[model samples]
Target: MSFALSTTVDLDFDRTVAALREALSTQGFGILTEVDLSGTLKTKLDVDVPRQLLLGACNPAYAYRALQAEERVGLLLPCSLTVRAGADGRTLVDAMDPALMVELTGTSALTEVAAEVRSALRAALDALETR
Candidate 1:
């Protein structure tokens, strides 16, 4: 089974990023970190590249519950939301399917949390589409 879902949209990179942040907010997820790979690579290694952004997203409640189940679960605390520009000049939004993600760990406590996360993520994706 796929752990993530992705969709390509016609918006430019910057707009897409904004839409993603909005979508995340609507789903009760806060973006804990944002990484601009293109800029980082260029500034750190002098390698110019296309647009690529990584967002570390988390729902604090779910994270805390998951951690209570397993402290080491922090390894996967924040889910990744990646946005990238294709060569065709289209933007793509990708996020993990928390249902599938939790399954990988085989933790019973994560099942209920995964359902909540899946709902939030689905809302996020719908929000992106409407934007």
Candidate 2:
């Protein structure tokens, strides 16, 4: 609960996704994977969900630091961000809070790395607000 950094934007889903990609890039993150959650669910389970996309974002330097701190941390490798359509017709963006790594691993060594990643993610979300 309360595990993400989120914002709602005025743009529609597709536009929001595009803007988010650029925003994340500005924060030194690259998309390592993308998933169209809505589409996949509709196809796989015949269930309909609101338009949703998941982006696996990664910043190499931060990731490396995390890896050095915890050998198994790569299991959580590549941060996740989601773009989804809200009922009000606005698009919502959410990024997984990096602090979760420290919580889950119970390691102080990852604290700094998590903070750096969190800041970058916050900056990226702020960038979306300006667009």
Candidate 3:
């Protein structure tokens, strides 16, 4: 299965990032971390690239449940979401598929938690459609 739920929006990069954050929040997620991929690459490797951001999104309730199911699940604690500029000047968003956690951990116990997370992530992505 594909590992990500992705969508493209017509907004500019910064606006798309803001919209993504808002959409996630509406679905009970919060941005735990943000990594500017473009800036990082430029600063660390001296290479220029299109604007890109990585957002670590977490829904605490789901996180707690996942942790309870598997102690090592922290390895996948926060779901990753990305907002990047496309070559055509549009914005692209991609969110990790939570179901992957179940496959990676080899545990059926995480099925419910993963389903919930997947639903929330899907909702967040759907919200972007209105933008």
Candidate 4:
């Protein structure tokens, strides 16, 4: 199974990133953290790489539901969304599939929450495609 849901955008990297954030917000997700992979690689290993960012996204209600279902689920809280420049010059956005939570936790209770999160993530990707 695909671990992520992804889409490619023809917009410039920065603009694509901004649009993704806005799209996620429209689906009730907030970016809790951002990691610049290029900067980190350059600083830590002196390696050059394409522009890449990892966004930690969270929907508060869904997070709370997951937490109540499994206390340790916080370890997987904040679904990961990545924005990176493709070799073809387009930007690629990838969101972690929330279904992984169900696979990892083996909790039937988390199924509904994961489905809701997946729907929101898929909507964000769908919006990006139309734009």
Candidate 5:
């Protein structure tokens, strides 16, 4: 199974990142954290790589539901998505598949919550494509 739902945007890295943030917000996901992956690597290791950013997106309603179902699930509370400049001259956006939570936790209680989060993520991706 694909671990992520991804798309290639015709826009440049900066534009794609902005568009993705707006799309995610439209789907009720607030970015809780932002990590400059490539910048960090370059600063620490002196390695050059494609521009990349990691966003920790979260929908409070789904997060609350998931936690109610399983306390330990907090470890995976925020959904992670990556935006990067692809070698092909376009920007790539990849979002984690929420269904994995159900499979990993082995908790039937999280099934509905996972599906809901997955749907929102799908909507965000769909919006990016159709926009």
Candidate 6:
């Protein structure tokens, strides 16, 4: 199974990131953390890129349920959404497939939560694609 779903968007990188954030929220997800890979790389390694953003998204209810099912699930707490610029000047938005992580963890309790997260992420990805 694919670990992530991705699509190249015609929008600019920054707009893509913003649209993804809005979509995720509309699907009941919140951005718990955001990392600017471009900025971090520039600062840490003096490397520069056009744009690269990482968003850690989470639905609180699902998170709570997952935690109840597996205490170590925190290792994969928030699903990640990435926005990066392509060589063609378009932006790409990618989201981690919760089902993949759930399978990796090997927990039956996470089955429902994984389904919900996958659906929510799919909705968010669809919205991003439209924008």
Q: lDDT of each prediction vs. the true structure?
A: 0.83, 0.94, 0.92, 0.93, 0.90, 0.87
TM-score of 5: 0.96
Looking at model 2, the pairs that clash are: none
Q: For every model shown, what is its TM-score relative to the native structure? A: 0.88, 0.97, 0.98, 0.97, 0.96, 0.94
Q: What is the C-alpha RMSD of each candidate to the true structure, in Å?
A: 1.6, 0.9, 0.7, 0.7, 0.9, 1.1
* Tens-digit lDDT track of model 1 for 22-108: 888877889999999989999999998888999999989888988877677787769888899988988888888777646767777
Model 2 lDDT, residue 129, Cα: 93
Candidate 3, 30-60: lDDT as tens digits: 9899999999999999999999999999999
Task: For candidate 6, write residues 17-67 as lDDT tens digits.
Answer: 788889888988899999988999999999888788889998999899889
Rank the candidate models, highest lDDT first.
Answer: 2, 4, 3, 5, 6, 1
Give the residue spans of candidate 6 off by over 4 A.
none
- Candidate 3 yields a Cα-based lDDT of 0.92
Off by over 4 Å in 4: none
TM-score of 3: 0.98
Better of 2 and 3 by TM-score: 3
Candidate scoring better on TM-score of 3 and 6: 3
For model 1, what is the error of residue 1's alpha carbon versus the real structure, in angstroms, after optimal superposition?
A: 1.8
lDDT of 2: 0.94
Model 1 residue 42 distance off true place after TM-score fit, in angstroms: 1.6
Scanning candidate 3 in windows of ten residues, the lowest lDDT window is: 122-131
The reply for model 3, stretches above 4 Å from the true place, is none
